[model samples]
Target: MTKVWEASVRATHSFLSETSIQKIKISLPKILQQIPDLIIVEDEKIIAFMGISHQELEMLFVAPEFRGLGLGKQLINYAIKNFDVNKLTVNEQNPQAIGFYEYLGFETYRRTETDDAGNPYPILYMKRKEN
Candidate 1:
């Protein structure tokens, strides 16, 4: 989690300052309370994880060293098949993530100026396009 978050979230999510990251680290227990379901990918060590609440994909992160290995797409595929997941939000600043989801047939349908946390970062709301 630390490796993936530092590589992905800390790198792309500008709204999260070092202070905010520290705060988030301390608040994991509280955050876990809201997440009813989670998906994890592990080998010798934990490679990635995702948190979902119903059809909404709340979180996903792949470790830096483990990215580009199709782990993320595989996880999303599992979510789609098992959980009927079709919607998720991404930070507008993370073009790589946007492209990945777009490659998987997700299309942005809404935009928000602030995230659910009321942060100033823009969020792109996306849903899978029907085949």
Candidate 2:
């Protein structure tokens, strides 16, 4: 079970390598120790969870049968309300996620480029300003 999550996170990091996902993964233990607001979506057969760090929200995943049901938004909103920070980074190439964040009132603050093992990718730094 833990192996599955590690693999999912690794695959997610591979897909969003521009966000320095590997660094985030490496630092996850510290992050979890500091901010342990994990939100889970569960059913009879499966469960999905989102793990958050101080400055980043990550692992927003849903089971195949549970996609497009506003669960992601629910999890993200819960995090925003519970965590002290308001910043998150996303791979610029993931249009759906970009749109999702935008829909939740997170705006792009800056753009970053990453060189991960000779691969280059774009990332967006997004923030929800405090009121």
TM-score of model number 1: 0.89
Q: Residue-wise lDDT of candidate 1 within 1-131, one digit each (tens)?
A: 55665666765666678987787777766776688988877787777899898898888989877779899999999999999999999988788899999999999999999877887778999999998
Alpha-carbon lDDT, every model: 0.84, 0.67
How many clashing pairs per prediction, in order?
0, 0
lDDT of 2 by residue, 90-120 (tens): 7786677788888888899998786323446
TM-score of each: 0.89, 0.66
Candidate 2 positional error at 101, Å: 0.3
